[model samples]
Target chain A: MKKIALGLLQVAGLTVFSLLVNTLTSLLHIPLPGSIIGMILLFLLLESGVIRLNWVEVGASWLLAELLLFFIPSAIGVMKYSKLLEADGLQVLAVVLVGTFAVMAGSGVLTGAIYRIKERRSS
Target chain B: MITGLLFLGLTIAVYLLAKRIYASSGKMYTSPLIITPLLIIAFLLMTGSSYESYNAGGKWLSDLLQPATIAFAIPLHKNFKVLKKHAAEIAAGVLSGTVIAVISSMLLAKWLHLSGDLATSLVPRSVTTPIAMSISQSIGGVPSITAVFVILTGVLGTMMGPSVLRLFRIDNEIARGVSLGTAAHGTGTSKAFELSSLTGTISSIAMILTALFSIGLAPALIAVFLH
Candidate 1:
């Protein structure tokens, strides 16, 4: 009972932090996601030693461990509009797939190039 | 109501099977994100279960994504030292990559004759959902459509990014992480985490940076190119 209560408390703490940041972002119109804002806030707290890692580590780890699972439902949210997408789906996929490759390729090559330049200059 | 609970149970059962297959096969070709969703989709097809019914359970689980995203900061915090070391280079790389992505998507939309709204929506699909949605709405695009495109881009990028990077011989964790996150956002970050914890942390930072940059860039882009 104590274990469950402690776990719930930790999760509640993290959730409260997340909601607080979410609210702030909306109020401020920050153009960034509330979750990312929440993340930055957590990072600041950790950095300042205001919030120890152990305080939220367990809850955070559990959430991250199954992060992909949470995305599935949202991903599959595609199916709700399956009919409208049926004709244009291939076109859409083509654009998206090509775009993905371009993005990855561009980022990877640029980062690698920068790394090499930095390495060569240092050496 | 029972459908929601039953659907959730079914998902867990299917996930285990998918996990076993993924492990046994050495995680080649199929990802849990891809394969498990395919299985559930197929099951829905066979069972004639509506997406809304499945979403009844799915939505509750998906709610966890908000906190999960916030929790991503833990990894970023742990890797702050390395982040500080390479901050400038990381920024340059992510900045160029996002520009390249936005440009390529715009060019592609033109070449394909995508409608005005569609083109506007597709431009920010490289970023994660929230940022992409915000950008889409601000630019006179359908946020829902942008979400679909963003999710699809992420799934495809995570599925093929590693091999594609291998073609360029870009094997460094920093490169991989930054590229994956910049290109595919959260989905790619999950794949990066699969590669290494350090890489995942870097990906989180890269993902956040790319979203922030795209926010500023999206307006100028549409004004200059689309108009």
Candidate 2:
């Protein structure tokens, strides 16, 4: 009972912290992403030793581990416009496949090349 | 009612398949992000249910994205020192890559004579979801289309990023993370985590930077190029 209660408390605490930070960012009209603001707040708390890592680790890990699952529904939103996809299905596929490959290759090459140059200079 | 059960069952099945594939390949091609979408599509085909019904339950799951995104901070905190060291180079690399990606895609779409909406949809192709969606909206693109593009970009980056890096022999963790995050967003960041903590941390930073840069630049670029 105690462990279960503690676990629940941890989850609630993290959720509240996340919500509070998100709210603060929105209210302040911060240009940064709200979730990012929440993250920074959490990081600050952790760094200051105000919130021990162990205390939040269990809850945060559970949430992060299932992170991809969280996007599943949003991905399904693709279905809402099934007719659109079916009509331009090939176009969508071509764009998604080709565009994705291009972005990955282009960014990967650029980032890798820049890092290599920096390494040579530093070393 | 029965649809809900079927959706749950399919989600479990895909989760299992993803686990099996990951165990063998240890690659993002087999990630849950890719697997789940494929599974959902398969289920839709097999059951003959429209996407609306499947989304009825699935939407609840996606609501967690906000919290999940915030959870990225933990990993970012762990990687601060590495980022601090290569801060300038990292910033320049990701910023340039992101700008190039947005510009090239928009230019290509215009050259191809694609509709304005299609061109707009392609604008936020490099950043993470929230920022991409917002950019798409401001630029008059369909947010849903941009979200789909963003996810596809992330999955592809996770799958092909390593090979591309190897082709260029770019082995630095910071570089790997920045490239992955810049191109693929959260999914790419997830792949970075598998490589190393430093890679994961840098990828998150790269993801954040790419989003900020793209969001600010996409509107201005659209005005210059499209208007």
Q: Per-candidate TM vs. native?
A: 0.94, 0.88
Candidate 2, CAPRI quality class derived from DockQ: medium
Model 1, position A9, has a per-residue lDDT of 76
Report the error of model 1 at residue B83, Å: 0.5
Predictions in order: lDDT: 0.83, 0.74
True contacts kept of 1: 0.73
Off by over 4 Å in 1: A1-9
Residue B94 CA error for candidate 1 (Å)? 0.9
Q: Tens digit of lDDT per residue, candidate 1, span B49-148?
A: 9988998888877777788889987888888998887787688879988888788888887888777788888889988888889889998889998998
Tens-place lDDT per residue, model 2, B1-227, is: 67766676677578667877887987656777777787778778887887777866666566566667777777766667777888876788787777777777677776666677977897897787878888888889998888877776666667777787787666878777877788788877777877887887888888888887887788887788876
| Candidate 2 off by > 4 Å | A1-12, A29-33, B1-9, B25-29
Chain B TM-score by candidate, in order shown:
0.95, 0.91
Residue pairs that clash (backbone atoms under 3 angstroms), model 1: none
Determine which window of 10 residues in candidate 2 chain B has minimal summed lDDT. Answer: B55-64
- Residue range A24-104, candidate 2, lDDT tens digits: 888888866677777778788877889778787766666666666776666666666667767665665566556655665
Q: Judged by lDDT against the true structure, how good is candidate 1?
A: 0.83
